[model samples]
Target: MTRFDIPAPDAAAHAAALERLDALVKPVGALGRLEELAAWLCAASGQVPPPPIERPRVVVFAGDHGVSRLSAYPREVTAAMVRVFLAGKSGVNVLAREVGAGVRVLDIAVDDDLSDVPAEVRAWKVRRGSGSIEAEDALEPGEAARAFEAGRRVADAEVDDGADLLIPGDMGIGNTAVAAALVAAALGVPAEEVVGTGTGVDEAGRARKVAVVRAAVERAGERVSDPFELLTALGSACAAATAGFLVQGAVRGVPVVLDGVFSAAAAVVAAEIAPEAVRWWLAGHRSTEPSQAVALKALGLTPIVDLGLRLGEGSGAVQAIPTLRAARAIIADMGLLADLG
Candidate 1:
């Protein structure tokens, strides 16, 4: 296991940024979430005014789940969406292009034979898809650790290539069900409270999903404090990989903006493994899923938007990038009140 010597973000820098923010011509908290967003950037990068994100990279880790067959959507949608992302036709691609950001799609565990994926976008495949947690562990033996490391390596390489900001997106049919199970087990909550109508399932489907999650949690035995074990037992390969990416983002001092419930569930595992990593994270948007809220609260993050978005594939996070850039502009260009005199 690669040891992550992640440090907490500098509190002094955050305080300094807040001090500067209070001196801006606008009234205190007038900018609302933007102020908080800017301050978080400062703290995250240890800069009084964080540098504008020049190379914002959105990486969608695509996988499949054995549980997808149980959901309303076809299991093949996961692979289909990977192709959409690669073609820059998905919501994430559209939003990234509009914000001057780049998108990379990873065929980490998609069930389709994505050998035709262009070299620039393809990543190592851990497997075709994870097992159904309703009956057994999601990953094969040793696969969990490998998935975790895959995520960390991808984040590290992106940062090495000068990516200033990272948005981890997910693409996997029935992933929300896996995420809901992880969240409920981690937080010791009931599945009914955490499970939502993923992909707009009908009431019967929703009830079935909830029951599946509850059974998975119960079958997993006692919740272990070890994050890797939790991931192997309850999370998809993409979820475990996402957790690894998030942990390494903080270790490398790069800020990470997390997308909806799947990302949030991975974040819960990341925080469990390294509590300090949470300091470098920002919630991009609030997903309509109740579990998303629970995961964010567990991480002590306030999301930048709340348009009831439940779309995964990093769409919600990518949509918030313009606002993030605007926040930077506000902190950097707003005149001081004293100067206004």
Candidate 2:
């Protein structure tokens, strides 16, 4: 089974981390989120002062969803959007430039044939995407394994390219429906709490989304309590890819910045599988998606960037990359008291 390295931080190392952080030439509470960053890095690395980063990597997974068939958005938008990403015109692309991060788009699913896999993408195309999930399971039991290995391959390549961190993203319309089903089943919350107006699905659209999820939850029966079972029931390839990245990342000890609802839902599944994996996931923003607040709370993660964003495509995740870099820069470059005093 896939997993993450989740051992508790050493008590002695914890003390040393506090000592080093206190010496950062400011009042104990002054640095705010930066202090949290330093401590988390310290705890994750089992060191007093975490090293600076170079070659940051962001892996954006673009997959087609079965739910899109029921939704208003057509499937063609996916490929067209991938084109935008390749053009470096998307928000994520712009932010990737800002953070000096390498971006790789992994195609695990799509409704139509995607030929000539773009050089900018890691083409792990899985059968022209999943068939409509409303009529059947999103992915077969074994197919999930194939999709997961694709994500693992992406993680390995990124790490080899000198990536010290991971930012995992997902792109798929009607994915919020998949995410909602996953949350309802995994967290034992009602489907209503998990459902959201994903990507501008107006009030009525969201109500319809909730009804769809409610039906799925009911059909899933007793097994709905198991997170993986739930994922198989309602999750899309994009959601699966994000979850796989989280699992792969934690197992390899890579810190990943999670985008909004879709990525966060993946984090929820991964955290259930590997509790230590939650430590690796940092929320980039609180999504405009209704369930984001509930989902993040369930995972005990607070978004460092609270931009009211609901757009998919990892816009939130890519944006947060700079914050991580900035945190490291302050610690690495700020003059030490011994150097100054």
Candidate 3:
């Protein structure tokens, strides 16, 4: 297993940020979660007022899942969407453009050659796609570590390139099935409670998906003790890599905005592996997926929005960027009561 030097968020900076917010010319708690966001950002950046985030980057990890053979969406759609993302034609692209954040579509394991995809997109293929967790281990031996290392390196590269904020998204067919297994195994919850209609599966399909998740969990059993083992047994490459991104974002002290259910699933594994990294994370929105709420509660994060969004390509997270910017603006532009008088 590869080593990760994860550290806790800065407590002194968090305190200073709260003090500054309290001194601002506003009611005791008018800002609500915005104030909390400002303090957390301050802790992340080690700044009292928190610097303006000029460069927000969204990295969408694309892959395919053998479990999709069980009927969530066409597995080929994963590669097709990667091409669309590379062409700047996906929901993530539109939202990222609206927020002035650059988007990078990374290929982890899409089960296709992706020859048509532009050369700029990052490619770190761990495998063509993970095996069906319903019957066997999702990832081969050591593949989980590779997925995680790929994510860590991507996070490092993004941060090194002046990206002040990170958004990790997912693009894979039947990922919700794998995500449910991850959540169920990590939280020790029943699979039926976490599984939901991913994409557009029918009721019968959903039932089958739930059964697959339950079987996957039962197959993994006690081996789920460690985060890596849980991922290898039930997580997709995209998911394992997203977990790495979360870990690396905290390790690098950069704020990470989580997307929908997929990102939350990765966060579950991340929270288990590095409990302190939760401080650097913020839920972008409350996805309609049932597992999303479970994962968020496990990490103790409140979503910035609850608009019933269930899109997976980081759209929800990008939608929340303006709120973060607004929080920063409040701290930077609002006049102090002492100065007003």
lDDT of each: 0.88, 0.72, 0.88
Candidate 1 lDDT score relative to the true structure: 0.88
**Backbone clashes in model 3, listed as residue pairs:** none
What is the per-residue lDDT of model 3 for residues 163-243, given as tens digits with 9 covering 90 to 100? 999999899998888899999999999998999988978899889988999999999999898999999999988898999
Question: What's the TM-score of every candidate structure?
Answer: 0.96, 0.90, 0.96
For residue 242, what is the lDDT in candidate 1? Answer: 95
Least well predicted 10-residue stretch by lDDT in candidate 3:
114-123
- Candidate 1 on 1-341: residue-level lDDT in tens? 45669877879989999999999998998998888888888888789788988999998999999789767789888888888887889998988898888998888888888767776555568988888998988988788789888999999999999999999999999898999998999988899999999899989998999999999999887844567788888888899889989999999999899999999999998888878888888999999998999999988888888888888989899878888998888899999999974
Candidate that scores best on lDDT: 3
Total clashes in model 1, counting residue pairs 3 or more apart in sequence or in different chains? 0
Clashes of 2: 1
Q: After superposition, how far is residue 216 of candidate 3 from its true place, in Å?
A: 0.9
Model 2 Cα displacement at 329 (Å)?
3.3
Q: In model 2, what is the error at residue 1, expressed in angstroms? A: 4.4
lDDT: worst 10-residue window of model 1: 115-124
